[model samples]
Target: MIPVVQHQWKGNLAQAREIQVFLAQKVILKPFKIKPETVLAVDVSYSRFEKCGYGVAGLFKVAFDNRRHKFHIVSEQYYTNSDTVPFPYIPGYLSFREIPILLPILSQISERPDLLLVDGAGIAHPRHLGLAAHLGVIFDLPAIGCAKSRLIGDFLMPGLESGAYEYLRTNGKRIGVVLRTKPACRPLFISPGHRCTITDAWRLIFTFCDQYRLPEPLRRVDLMSKRMRKQIEKK
Candidate 1:
């Protein structure tokens, strides 16, 4: 597998291979008043011909009412790098290549977020470590990893509610959960990043998930990242 781990943010291929444990490490095992004020989501795009992935990060604040939910993309960052992804596309080290760029963009936000919703895993990893967990560790902020597919663990099955979830554990340790977002829709791979427990992660994700499979803040960000990538490729 490729082992690209960049620390200098120089877009160097060699730097992208320094496999480190994680970039962030704040673990949130308890619950707190999770206000849906601000959230951030990150996604990367690769140039198949150039052998590199460009990262585009989006941070949006939620504007909610009794009738609906909406968001405004207040900040975004796009950067190019030669990060050769290592680790066989595994968990734990996902943030090594992507987060290096993401963290820089996140740090520049004018307002600190109440919560961050990552596009990868949180605790649902082979090492019980995912991108969200890594970011939480580094930032010491409450965060969640919401993935579209399963990375590890086993569960009985989720219900048809918007927030129904089943715990995902490995080696007798609770990692993440298989959660139902919309009734009859595919489940999301959810996990706590740091300073958060399984239950808190579930509550937070369920709240932001709202009526979409992903949180309003992140759902739009995902589309924004794709657009950024397309623009970058066109250049």
Candidate 2:
């Protein structure tokens, strides 16, 4: 996949914040018109002591058997570059720290995914541009953010049953949802990144989730990234 917009990844904090504000305007919230047959999930694991990061991108084919959806891995790619992380760990500027490594892995995947599931925030962010929104705008693809924790929002606890969810709002405007993917498990913060609406984001994530707090595709890539980081540490 190629980027629709180009911008420098390395910059000071002020410049980074400016870029987020500028790009956030380009995020398009609409229905994803296609029935996605394939999805690509991307995640990064940092070795802070080594000042390096490992990124993994996995492409999974969506399958339907017995009226239930399943995701099967089609291909997986890892970033093996030795480039030292250029940016420090900051709460709001995650795209700067991880996107450089992830883009290369994304480019390596031969088949373009119908949807992108990111393991981070989207418009739920304070600047309205998080890692998922940034990537979706760059690729011009429909993407969703499935974050493990809330960044900025006020939400009541969802019901204990699976698939239960509550709206996550900021200043009286809904930005995302606090979703319960599994019974009695911690909820996930989900939002539209770009080219999709809030309802679409939560619905898709709920469908992909099975017996786990995270959706299957995202869980796979998260494990892949952590394994890659462990391998590097052993070396």
Q: lDDT tens string, model 2, 10-124?
A: 5789999999999999999999877787888888888857498888887777764436754444445443433567788799999998888887777766676789999999899
Error of 2 at 96 (Å): 0.5
Alpha-carbon shift of residue 39 in model 1 (angstroms): 1.8
**TM-score of each model, paired residue for residue:** 0.75, 0.93
lDDT of 2: 0.86
Each model's lDDT comes to 0.64, 0.86
For lDDT, the strongest prediction is: 2
lDDT of 1: 0.64
- Per-residue error for 120 in candidate 1, Å, reads 0.9
Clashes per model (N, Cα, C within 3 A): 27, 0
Give the runs in model 2 whose Cα sits over 4 Å from its true position: 48-50, 69-82
Query: Which pairs clash (backbone N, Cα, C closer than 3 Å) in model 2?
Result: none
Clashes of 2: 0
